[model samples]
Target: MRSILIALPLLIAAPAWAQGDDSELWLTATGEVAVADKTSIELESINRFSDDSGGLYEIELAAGVKRSLGDGWYIGGGYVRVVNYSRGTVTRTEDRLRVQGGFSTDAGPFKLSGRLRLERRAASTGDEIGYRLRPNIKAALPLGKSDFRLFAAHESFLPLDDTDWGENAGHDRMRNSIGVSWKASKAISVEGGYLHQYRLPRNGRTSATDHALTFTLGVSL
Candidate 1:
């Protein structure tokens, strides 16, 4: 398990390294609160810095609620506000609403999960309401009986329709991440990882790729 985890990033990153065009850093903080026996609320903040954008380029704040259906299945919905910055100035702002369903199950020593999400997005720079679909999958392995776990995840972004702002009607981008998470206590946890994002060329746009170092701090209550 350890050896596989160590090699996962290298193997996944080989093609990305050859095609990556930008470097970035991403930081995120999230909090979750149990509101009922099978329901919880979550809040997240994400900040992204990009070499091409000169500095901090994107910021996202999101709030969501999740309801467990028992038997490792769940449903969730969320609203997100995204702000794009360029050279310390705000360039565009977007509002997004998403609904998703997912399932998680234990497969031997590995914990596996997958989700399918649909999103409706409105941006300050565009008149059309963009629709998107996202499919994500993740796997995690516990490191002995310790407080740490190794994980890998992949997600694809598919635009359901063309938008004036930039979203084209087709396969958009995908993200692949490999990381380690440490549970600091019952209430707090931390994660760090490498993420590679590749955007497919569509509607005369050139393909682009970004390599990012990602970190997250999470809290639960």
Candidate 2:
């Protein structure tokens, strides 16, 4: 019962050094797939970052990618893999990788689109967390599409490395959410939200600003 850092799975460590301009004008990418008719189907990610002043910021590796597609639907492009056991260890890739294009319209029953993501992370406990970011929002009925919708985010994290494990931790980590989105189509969907955060130990729950949940089951063309 230690879980924090916005809902955990044990990921921390990786981010040799990163300060600014990694490219792609300042990267951003997002990808997902979720299908839950019987469970065991999920994939999700966010990349591109830079937010400072010791609330923490900086992720300087580059390209990240993941995969998993079955009854749940999955895809991979970047943000490789990571786990922060309150500051244990996990790492795969880094530098720059973010994606976003245009148009996915509909607002009556709900369906909207916007994209940009990229991440090269790993830094859960020691430095708090490193962020490679691409900020963009408006997800109403996603992951197979609509079981529930409504979401919002304002992000910035460019923390490549800094570890004393104190001074505002890793700096700048903010998230506000409203939940319930479970789709089993277009690829997949399953989400849980309503988490106001700033954390550092998940899977058991400690505290740093509590009650947060995130789920990912993904796939996209």
Candidate 3:
């Protein structure tokens, strides 16, 4: 636990590459099943589009299992695969394994949480290995007498290794988002939000900022 806490800051200080400025749109679908009182299985698929919803650029599929540790603490692990498309051609693919842990607590009329995740990534370019760390915090406010809640979150990712593509050693990406979640039914919920992302370059290029409109549909079974 102490070592994990110490690793968070170190990972943020490592070196990375530039993504030119752009706006994007994202749609995500997610489902979860309870295998036990304290354990659950989760799955998600996401689609990413470029500015003006002009073109499809990326798709991601992920699955994972999570377990409660009691008292608002939890641990989970997952695998993800992402495919990138550009100019009507499949350009790159990334496969990643991730382990994460977090804690949540309630304050008056709100819930707050923090999470830490570590990842091992392999890309199709050369199938090289790289590592990453991500830390984030979230807040939720429930609307009185309604099944709607306001959500806000901020997260940052740091690359930890040098690969054939480039050195992703420093603060690579940051995302700030705000959204509203509506409980449409007992087992279904939807969320819509906007995200602002900032990215730094690894190949000595200019950095970029991306504005994105995001929507998610979640179902629990």
Best by TM-score: 1
Q: How well is each residue in 1-221 modelled by candidate 1, as lDDT tens digits?
A: 65465456657666766667988889999999999999999899999999889999999999999999999999999999999999899999999999999999999999999999999999999899999999999998898998788899999998898888988877889998998887889999988778989888777888888998788999999
- Tens digit of per-residue lDDT, candidate 2, span 1-221: 21242222212111211221121112222343334432232233432222222211222332334343343233435434432111222232223344322234577756554444544444433534444444444556432432444454433333444434432323344444455554557655545444344444433544343223344444454
Model 3: per-residue lDDT, tens digit, 66-108? 9999999999999999998985679888999999999999999
Model 3's alpha-carbon lDDT is 0.82
TM for candidate 1 is 0.91
- The weakest ten consecutive residues by lDDT in model 2 span 16-25
Model 2 stretches with alpha carbons more than 4 Å out: 1-28, 31-56, 59-62, 66-68, 73-148, 151-176, 179-195, 198-207, 210-221
Cα-based RMSD of the predictions, in order?
2.9, 16.0, 9.6
Residue 107, candidate 2: how far off, in angstroms? 22
Scored against the true structure, residue 90 in model 2 reaches a CA lDDT of: 29
- TM-scores for all predictions: 0.91, 0.25, 0.86
